[model samples]
Target: MRTPLTAGALLALALAAQPALAKGPATSPNEAATARHYASLIAGSQPNMAELTLFFTQMPKGGDLHHHYSGAIYVEQYVDFVDRQGYCVNKQTYRIETDKALVAAERAKPAAERNCLSSAEIYADDHTWRELLQRWSNKDFFNHGALQPPPDRLFFQTFGYFGPVSNSNFKEGLQELKKRAIAENVSYIETMFKLSPAVANPDFDAKAWQNANDDAAFDAQMRAWFAVLDKDPAFNKTIADFVARIVDSSEGIDDERFTMRYQTYVLRLLNPSLVFSSMVSGFKAAKSSDKIVGVNIVGQESTNISMRDYALHMKMFRFLKSVYPDVKVALHAGELAMGDVPPEGLKFHIDQALTVAGANRIGHGLDLAHETNATGIMQTMREKDIPVEINLTSNAFINGVEGSHHPINLYRKYGVPYVISTDDAGVTRHTLSNEYVLFASRYKPSYAEMKKTSYNSIRYAFLPVAEKQRLTRQLDQRFADFEAKIARLAKTAAKAP
Candidate 1:
């Protein structure tokens, strides 16, 4: 009998035989070699997490598609802003205090009783510094035994603490994000930067609430409101100013090696008129500037207002798309888990986002299996070529969804396109590289699949065709260099004693 092939030999044959296993074209020799080494790192039952982290840290991630602007700024950086603005932090509450009267009153108290501390004082007090880190981010939340709120609540609440200063240092914040993205080999970013301006019309809200469930009536009503908004000077000026802010804040952020785009979002936790009006402004903002590539809706999806207005919000997107057909949308649908909302609430988010909103992409599609006609939804996504942004860390921290429980495996099994992204890297206190590490170790996808996912970030990005092509070409070189480096590392390891 012929001698049986060694496990290593079997892996080699498998890699050679299926060099083009993923959706794209055949891999280059360097990619194939990298695949072999990658398999070696993550092959066994307990994969090498350390090596996997290093591998993905050096890997080329094409883009971060579902990024949030304010949430992507670290708390430490926000503290710097606090210092620059001469603001004080409430030591007891761990919140930034800007009220001069309150600061003066707190300063009048004895040192031990004082509640407001300056940034310098906060740093000097090590306990307050550590507490601020924990409160501002996911740091030490899981590892320690402290009285804490639910993960999802804590995740959303961080915004309240940092909101006052989030928009103040716009250009500086963009520079910080660019520096971090380059260090991790991320070629592009599509961030949901800020909320568009909103105006309340009680007359409009009453009519909208009455017609919320009727698509035809709602569409007609929305058209009339759009005409009114078109003539409203204040509304138009707000849209213009919103576009100007984006253009001004994003100066000097793009280069040959990196690209960044903004998406103006509407918060869902607002009155009907405010939400719909903001949606209109968001689309107009996208139309006004090439740098503003798309519009998005963002908030805690399971909030009382958000859940009640979920379908209405999707309809809002649908109607706006009719008006601004060229503008793109990427809805944060199906972000809720089982207990976060009632069972029926989970049934139609992803479906409505696709079938109604006509979203180009879906973010945090965690409720895929729970949706109505789940299989059909996946089929529609596959046929329509819409990709889902999978945020493994965000999902785990916010919704406790990870490991085999994540729907990513389902997306893969059904051939629905998906992209790995860092939803809010700064708030979660992780990197795109760490997100990749989680994906690789948990799923054990082939090197080609991982590479395809990287390309998918660029492919599914809301950029003009020429920009997408330019980024695609840059990504090609990035991966080529990255794979060659891995291959060299593999060869060097082989030759080592």
Candidate 2:
């Protein structure tokens, strides 16, 4: 989340941390004095702006658990890939237009008339491209803008714009994303993506739900959907081929780690039967394959379909949990703010997500105060050890929730495990490191605390226990190496003067 404290408030906080600033010092007097004097100016007793930024850039963020595989990748890569494919970026909205005929037309035009002239040209006119990017995603490139939609709308729309190109080449996309993750010092990512292409059509999906009250009818419809999957061997083949590609490409990378887990996500705003059937299919798939780890209900939870069927979805998961007990779940719950929906609507999302859906993890539990008996909810999560995946940029962009209004500090205060994530990094124009920077600078998390967040991802991941243990050890070694590098850099920087 962006800083909610005003400049004056931040200045005051910085000035007030004088005594605490006196404690820790570098070995060298010059560095120690510089650090001490700078500490006096931090509200959270964080490092100075320059050093803090360097820390952020160098921080070894362990994994990106809440990332969207396609959206987690950098946009510059997409541009280059499509340029080679001879695809044209739509002139009006800048969406990637991959039509072969349109590509031909775009090629016919002079390079200047092409939708994407060049990266340098785009950066040269940063103001114009930034405006377009804001429309595409919820980026705070230009703070003073009346033209951009609300943060939530802009952030969500980015997916729609990038979806076409993203879906076209999953293997290439995953490979490129893994490469960047390696560069950014990230290991392991539990990314969200639709699995098996078995999503119910909206029309049939609605009719299926009309009979949801009748268990037999609902069961019949589920059978029909499964039959559709059975009939379409191509769908299964697609998944098999995709998984093969991922395994082949991610063979022996040393710098970073990669593990793929599919979230058989259903559109929450869909009909109840559709959502229930999807969950059933998701479980059925995960039970059959190791690659598809869990099920998730996504999209705006504030919508009518989502709010009305919230309890129903949870009950479905509960029922499925009995059968496919091993199939993991990480739900999107408590994503709404107080004013985004009705007062009553906010009262029970987190509770239902935990008690009803039996979610092992939750994405964006931002509206903690909105739940009924939030204290009990917090207690339940603590006892259950269900971690809340906090996507700072997404929360700030989508719900306008930040700073004191956010429950990050509160979760810490309550001992509820929480890990920071980039819910949709591409949509937010950020990397995992950027999210860490915001937290480190604003929250002043101690080195141990930051490392704890990395450990949390493994604890909550759907990987097998043995794999998790091995990864945990690897992560500890990586953390040590990272700190050594940082310490070495500090020494070198000290020597330069």
Candidate 3:
């Protein structure tokens, strides 16, 4: 479901939109003039793409709330990391098939039995390198025929291919994300990441919670599961290790200067026991660690396993909430579409996520329009003040939903809060800049409205109340400075010979 636009079509559209800019909101006379100036420079009339890009790139994007660390990182960076660790790639699968430990284990065995090759051995040829890039991301993917894999499969399968490389490149990967985020003028990031592996519960009774008939029974069942999990010495060690990994990954970054937070997650497609155990460990980690702020459920929401266990997972979060009251939950709900799943499937995901699981924020709430009592749901969201993290590129690429079909305009109409974000920039081959460009060019929001959405990200973030206040102040100063710079640039251009 990647943007179906071909390269030639995109170029043609860009060249064709060179007449006038859409009219933005009216404000005070001075402010309206500034808005007009800002619009003019970034409008389709601006012939220089570089200037338009720069104008928006330098514009302060307050924060990105729905980032995935592994997906946020450039795949080439992971390739470089794999090569640095002396790991090797699979030429056929184009996957990072070896890790440092695996290589060491291979060395302990007979040398000739090893099944690995150097990065150079695999990527020495230009064709091989291009194949690897295609395998790891959705770049230039429009030309593949029906004989080739579908777009969703190509996009999701890349995670499995680069899983090993990303697992080992935490520090370098974060540095890459930080560098890019800074460049795009994004000041804060609430990126989803996981460093925890669950220790299998020997006495796990998977059926105890699965067949519960009522909320009370389900709550009791999960409480029993947690009671047993809390006693595992090895399980406790996993939580500590997960927190240590985050701190280690962020050794030199100053939170005071550049803000960042982690949201550890449970893979929704996994077995119930594994997912539940991961959820416990993740929320426990968040309760104790300053770095990990919340928990989320990952994997495609429309998959069979996830769809079946969706409410059960929400119930699990509801139960865990009583145990770890301090921990936050931001779920990926309503990423489904009528085209991809049955109409009935979209009815209550965002609804249950908000009302049942007590989600603090919702990510990719694309099916909001299809929910049962959709207007009431939007009303509840406005009342609860929970924000939706809108990933324009991800939604468009994954569900083929954008522009009018997208619920963003509805969200605005109903007074629901939403923040713009880049869900998987590396996978989608886009950036925060690309997202802003889409929003500005498509929605034509005024300078104030644009800045307000940026502000919404920090306001609804799961940080401490004190930190939120500080960030709000910081954004005010940053936006003022950026507007001044843009104004000067506009004035200088007007007087040009």
Residue 286 of model 3: what lDDT? 90
Q: Which ten residues in a row have the lowest lDDT in candidate 1?
A: 1-10
Model 3 residue-pair collision total: 1
* Model 2: lDDT to the true structure: 0.68
Checking candidate 1 for backbone clashes, the offending pairs are none
Tens digits of per-residue lDDT for model 1 on 277-378? 999999999988999999999999999999998889988898889889999999999998989999999998998999889999999899998987676677
Model 2 lDDT tens row, 310-360: 766776777778767988999898999979998988888888788777899
TM-scores of all predicted structures: 0.94, 0.79, 0.87
Instruction: In angstroms, give how far residue 497 of model 3 lies from its true place.
Output: 5.6
Could you give candidate 3's per-residue lDDT for residues 82-115 as a string of tens digits? 7787777766667665657876675475644544
The TM-score between candidate 3 and the true structure equals: 0.87
* Predictions in order: lDDT: 0.89, 0.68, 0.77
Pick the TM-score winner: 1
RMSD of each: 6.8, 7.5, 7.8
Q: Which stretches of candidate 1 lie over 4 Å from their true place?
A: 1-26, 104-114
